[model samples]
Structure formats: structure tokens, C-alpha cells
Target: MHILMVSHFFESHLGGIERVAGHLSRQMIAQGAELTWAASAQDRAPVDIPALALPCVNPTEKLTGLPMPIPGPGGMAALWRAVGRCDAVVVHDALYVTSILALVMARMRGRRVVLIQHIAGIPFASSVMRWVMGLANAMVTRPMLWAADRLVFISDTVRRDLIGDPARRDYALLFNGVDGEVFTHIGPAAQRLPEGKRRVLFVGRFVEKKGLSILRAAAAMRPDISFLLAGAGPIRPASWGLANVHDLGPQKPAQLAALYRSADCLLLPSVGEGYPLVIQEAMACGLPVICGAPTDRADPEAGQFLRGVPVDLSDPDGSAARVVAMLDAPCLTLPERAQMAAWAAGRYSWAAMARAIMGLMAG
Candidate 1:
């Protein structure tokens, strides 16, 4: 099968959906599918597979910290050609300009399109921005979702909230998978915690939606606890100048797995998310996770091991207080940690996720 996969950025972009696409692309290729990844030229695609780099200008991300890349005229034309040759088209999400365009072009060309919706709505700090996102979802996202031949929702919260009735809608709920080989429980559980302070790790882009400011507030309240931050973005945690805050910048998978094994807990305070790959990775490595209330409940099975706290963008201190309370709660036992790791390894499988997506594409 000649499959054309489209995303806003390549896996190197350091976001959830991009990473999922990268894994799916490799798995599909391993299963003997001819996959062509198409995305913004801002990041390079995997050299092993064929890729079409669409030249784009990312003014939205630069100005607002929302990565919305608009492909140039020439790049759009190139995508048009790729869609014509491909047997099927797979789009990551419907919100992106690239995704919306791909949906329209694929439909016009009579190619099968499968949309994998990753998130429902991001609760932005700015009221105007929130309103704008809502309008975009109603005007653009919903329409593309209905237009696609098959729809796959990664989060139960998103599917339930967006579609309302799964009994009537034709959609599949597939949770993302984690690489057990890379992320597994390592070393003694006691050795995981440092002697002096408890370490809380945050992995993902430093965006307002990711709740870095709230984390910073939490860090300020707890001077003794060390906050190890992984990933970089417009919002610089290093600039916050907190004594306990250590910004490690973006990390590779192996390095991230090491962090997961070393840290006392994993923290992701963002809202409007699907079940994040980081949460799965942390669990696979036997690290406990604390995230926003909505996402902690993204998946019921995963939620059992996660701790969720209400996030109020307006009241950073209050949000931070709740995070601190979760942190202060008793740590999971060594056996409990092992149990968490085993649960993740047994539940999430990259091969399974790839097979399901390919089946949908085939239909």
C-alpha cells in the first residue's frame, strides 16, 4: 500500500502527535507498506523513509507559541502531486492548516483519508485566544472530521466530548503505544530518588497550555524539591531564575527514559490533551505521574495510576498548591512501581497501534 502520512511537523519537532506519527510510519514500513511522510519543512523527516517537506512560514508559533505552519504555494503544489500518487492519506489532526488542506485535496482526488484526532481543545490563558480556538474547531476541525473516511480518536475524553454518541459515529478509539525496550524499570527503586531532595520531571514544550507558569509557582512554594525540566520553547523556565528549577532542554528518547527512571515523579500540568505518550513512558519506567484533572482521566486504566489536580490559569498559586499537595502525598511502594511499569508494558504496544491504523486505511 502506498500510504501518505501528513502531520504539522516531523517527529523531531518534540511533540506528542509528531512522535506518534514517527512510530506509526516506521511500523507501517516494517509491515511492507510504502509510506510517504509529508509535513512542514521546519523539521526534517526520518531519512529512512520517503518524505515531502512542505515549505512553510510559522508566524503563529513565533508570535503566540502555537505552532501553526502555513505551507508556501510551491509546497502545496508538491503535496497535491503526492496525494495523487498515494493509495491512501492519513492526517494527524484536523486543526492544522496542512491537515485541512490535505483532507480537501484527498477528497477532491478520491483518495481514502483517515484522521487521527489527538486533542479536543486547549484552554488558553487569553479569553480571545480560547474563543478563536473554539471557532476554528467548530468551523474547520468538525467538518474535516466528518469529511474523513475513517476517524480515530486517541483520547476517550476527546471522543466523548466531540462526537457525543460513539454508538452512532463511525470511529475507533486507539490509545498510543510506548516502546517497552527503551522505557522500562531500571536499577533499584531506592536509587531512583536522590539523597537530598525529591525530583519532579516535566517533559514537553514550554507553552502556556503546558502550564509551565503554574509549575514554576509550585516550585517556588516548595524550595526543597528540585524541578527538572526537559524540552524547550518560547517560554523559558530557565529565565524564571528559580533556585530549584533545572532546565535540561529537549531530550532524546533514551535520555528521557533515563530521566524517568531517575526522577521521583513525572509532572504534566497541561490541559486539552489526549493520553500523552510521556505519561505512558513514565509509567513504563515505573515513574508516577501527576497531570491536569482532565488528562489524568483521559484513559480510565491509565488514570488509576495517575494523580490529577485542577488547573486554574488565573490563579497560578492555587494550582501550584494542589500540585504540591499531590507531591507531598506518600510515594508509591517499590512493588507498586513495578506494577505500574508492568501494566504499561502489557497494555501499550506500537505494533498493535500500527496494525489497527493500517486496517482502517485499508478499508
Candidate 2:
């Protein structure tokens, strides 16, 4: 089958959406499907899957955090030309302009459309903006849900929270994966930290909904633990004014794997996520994860993982106390770490996820 994947941005960017989309596309190609990617003109795919770069610009950090494609008349014309020849269209997002255009073009061409959503809804800073985005999601999502032949959600939590049930008869909760071979253990993790300090790693964009602000207070509360933030975005982690916090900027997979191996644990207090690849990656690297509970947030699948604690970020001091207590607790032993990695390896992987998505395609 010929699959055209519509992504807002591919390479030259570091985010869950880009990485998950790229990994799945490669797996699709490996599964005997001819996959072509349509993304921002500046973006490129790491693998052999061909990329069609459309005109894009650096706008404010809204929506996806990455730069968005300027799906102008020319861009839409380009997408139409590309879609005219594809067998099936898999759009990674339902909110982006490129995705909207891809869905419309696919419908017009009588092609099957599969819409993949990594998030339940758009998170905003203000209540007014949140309400506006909620309204937009409702208005836009309805048609796409009706038009698409099938829908793919990254996590069961998101599927339940966003649409209530899978009664639509054409949806699946295919979780993302991490490269266990790469995120392998590298000796003792305590050795990578300061003299007597435990290392706590946070890997995600420094955005509002990510809940990095709470990490600042937690770091100050527990100066014995070394906090390393491994991402870049609108808000710099070091700027939060925690002397114990170290900014590692953005790291490549190999470097990230080493960090995971050496770090005592992974901490991500983010909300509004459909399961994060970083969580899977940290687990694969054999690091226990301490993340936000997805009770109200998307990512309930995360609640199943071990070697971690789930804390509600609503109460700043309470959340900090959880981290403080966890820090004082013993880190995961080698056997426990191996068990954690194996659990993630056995259940989630790119090949498995791609096959599940492909299963949704009409034969």
C-alpha cells in the first residue's frame, strides 16, 4: 500500500509527535508499504522515506510547539498534487492546517483517511484561550471523525478521555515505543550524579502544561538530588532559578540513553499528553519514572508502568513532597531496572504500533 503521512514537522525538530511519526513511517516502509512524508519545507526525515517539504514559518509557540507549515494556496496545491497519487492518507494531527488540508484532499480524491491523534485536546495558558481551543476542537474534530475511514489514538487513556468509547468501530489504542537496545543500562546510575546526590532527569519541552514550574520548587526542596532538564522551548529550565538544576539542553537518542542509564530516575510532570515516548524511553533505559497522574490528563496507560510514582501536580507543595520522598527512597536495583525495561520492550515497539495502524487500513 502507498501511504502518505501528513506531519507538521519531521526532522530538525525534537518532539514526541515527530519522533513517533518518523518511527511509525519507517516501520510502515519496512512492512512493504511505500510511505512518503509531507512536512514543513525545512523538515527532513532521517530514514529512506521520501519527504515533501512545504513552505513553513516560525510562529509563536502555540498548538504543537514546533514550527508549523504555512499551508497557503501553494502549499495546499502541493499537498493536493502529492495526495493525488497516494493509496491512503495518514494524518498525524487533527488540528494543524496541513492535516485539515490532507483530510479534505483525501476526501475529494476518494482516498481512505486515517486520522492519528497524539493528544486529547489543545492546552492553553488562559481560560479564554482554553475555551476557544475546546470549541475549535469540537467544531473541527467532528467532521474529521465523520470523514476519516479510521481513527488511531496513541493511548487508551486519550481514547477514553477524548471520545468516551471505541464504539466508532474503526479505532485502536496503539501505544508508542522506545529503542531498548539503545536505551540500555550503563553500569551504576548513582555514579553519574554528584558525590552523594541522586540524579533526576526531565525530558520534555519547557512549556506551561509540562509542569516544569513545580520541578523548580521540588529541586529547591531537595538539594541533595541533581535535577537535569533535557529539552528546550519557550521557557528555559535554568531560568527558573534553581541552583541544583542543570540544563542539558536537547540530547540525541544515544546521549539521552546514556543520561537515562546514569540518572537515578526520570521525572516528567507534564499534563495533556497521550502517553509520552520519553516515559517509554526512560523505562527502556532502565530508569524508574516519576510522572503526573493522568486521572484528568490523557495517558492513563502510563499508570500501568512500574518503578515510579504518580503525583498530582495541582498542589505544588504536595507534589514536591512526593519527589522529595521518592528521592530519599532507594533507587531501582539492577534486577528491578531490567524488569522495567523488559516490560516496556515486550508490550510497545514501533513495528507493533505500525502494524496495528496498518491493520486499520481497508484491505
Candidate 3:
């Protein structure tokens, strides 16, 4: 089957959805399915695929994050040509203009379009900002979702919150997957840590919704612990102003994998997320998590191997206290951690995800 993958950003972008789109595209090709990709021409990711780079302007300063004008006049013919040739068009997010355009074009060509929802709405710091997003989604994206041939929700939270009763068919809960084998431990020799100092790693862009304020407060409250923050975006970790926190900047997949294997634990207190690929990578690396954002996929059976800890997102001080308490609490032994990694490797492999998606795409 021929599948066309459409997204605003691809491998060059450092978001969960972008990374998954890259994975899904590669897997589709590996599984003998013909694949084509469409994204902002400005995205200069080194991906080996038949990708149509459409013209777009990234309005980073805009309140609406998904405001990239997809398939400008010069790119319309290219996008439509791709749609006409594909059996199915798999668009990443329902709300992005790029995705919306792809959906419309695919529908025009009598092609099936699968809309994979990363999250229902964008994450915001203020109630006002979130309110704007809600209004736009209700008016714009909901109609497209209903029109889609297949609806794939990344997390149960999104499904329950956004879609109370889906008047759609062929819907599935598709959790993000990663290559666990790449993130697994090497022999007995592990990275040695300083005496009595456990490494707590936080991975994600330094954005408002990533719970940066909470993480900063938590890092300050617990001076006894060492925290390493990974990822780079518009925000910077230096603004947090804590000595215990060190910025690792953006990481390549291999570097991130090594860090996961070496770290004592993963701690992300983000306000919005479906099932992060980072959490799955941490589980595959046999590292336990202390995430404030919990979903159904946060469970061990769901391949995240989540060791959830409750913390008030509104109160960073409370989140810090919870971090300290979780550290003080008992953790899994080496053998158990190994078992967790094994289970995650089996359940959340990219190969498995590709197979499931193929089944969904098959009309």
C-alpha cells in the first residue's frame, strides 16, 4: 500500500509527534509499504524519503502554534500530486493548517486519511491562552476529525477529554513507540555516580507547558540531588537559575539513549503530553520515571514502565517536595529494571507499531 505522511515538521523538529512521524515513515518503508512525506520546506532534516518540501512561514511569535500556512500557491500542485498517487494519507495533527490541507486534498482525491491526534489542544501557561486554543479547536479541528477515515488517539486522556462519544469508525488508541534495543544497557560496566548523589534527568523542550517553573522550583528545593535537563527551544534552562540543574541542550537519538541508560531516574512534570517517546525510551533503558503528567500509557503494561508520582502542577513547591519524597522512596532492583526493559522492548517496538498502522490503513 502507498501511504503519504503529512506534518508541519518532520525529523528536524524536536517534538514527540515529529519524532514519531519520522519513525512511522521509516518503518512503513522497512515493512515494504511505499511512503511519501510532506512538511515545511524549511525543515532541513536528513531523512531518506520521497518528501515534498512545501513552502511555509513559521510564525513562532504567534499565539497559535499551528499557524504555518501549508502548501502555499507554489506548493499546491506538488501536494495534490502526492495525494492523487497515495492510497491513504496519514496526517499527524488534526488542527495544523498543513494537516487540514492534506486532509482536504486527500478527500478531494477520494483517498483515505488517517488523523493521528498527538494531543487535543496545545499546552499553555495562562488560562486565557488555553481558552483561545479551545475555541479554535472546537470551531476548526473537530469537523475535520469527524470527516477522517480513521481516528488514532495517542493517549486515553485525550480520547476521554476531547471525544466523549466518537461518532466515527476504525478508531484506535495508538501509543508512541521507540527502538528499545538502542536504549538498553551494555554489560555490567555502568556509568558511576558521585557518592549519595542520584542523577535525575528531565528531557523535553524548555517551554511553558513542559512544567519548567515546577522543575526549577523542584531543583532548587532539593539541592542534594543532581538534575540534568535536555532539549533546546525558544526557552532556556539557565532562566531557572539553580546550581543543581545542568543544561545538556538538544541531543541526537544515540546520545539520548546513552544518557537514559546511565541516569538514575527520569523526571518530567509537564502539563501536557500524550505518551512521550522519551518515557518509552527511559523504560527501554530500564530507568524508572517520576512524571507529574500521567496517562493510561504511563503504566508498565502500556510499555512506558511508569513509576508515577503525584504532584500538583499549580504548585511547583509541592512538585519539588514530591520529587524529594519519591527519591527517598524504595526503587526497583537491577533485575526488576532489566525485566521492565525487556517487557518494553517487546511491547513498544517500532516494528510492532508499523504493523498495527498498516492494519488500520488497509481498507
Report lDDT per candidate: 0.89, 0.75, 0.76
Error of 3 at 130 (Å): 1.5
lDDT of 2 by residue, 1-363 (tens): 889998888855777788888888888999989889888775555657788778766574565343456666677788999899898999986877788889998999998888998876645445765786688678986567667888888877667756777454557667787775676665433246446577889998777667776788788898777898998877777676777899989888888888888887788876667778888888777788777656223345445554334554456677677767766776667887888787777777888888878888754
lDDT by residue (tens digit), candidate 1, 265-349: 9999888888889999999999999999888877878877888899977678899999999899988899999999999999999
lDDT tens digits, residue span 41-75, model 3: 87675458878888877775344333354557777
Show the lowest summed lDDT stretch of 10 residues, model 2. Answer: 295-304
* Model with the higher lDDT, candidate 1 or 2: 1
Q: Pick the winner on lDDT between candidates 1 and 3.
A: 1
Ranking by TM-score: 1, 3, 2
Per-prediction count of colliding residue pairs?
A: 1, 0, 0
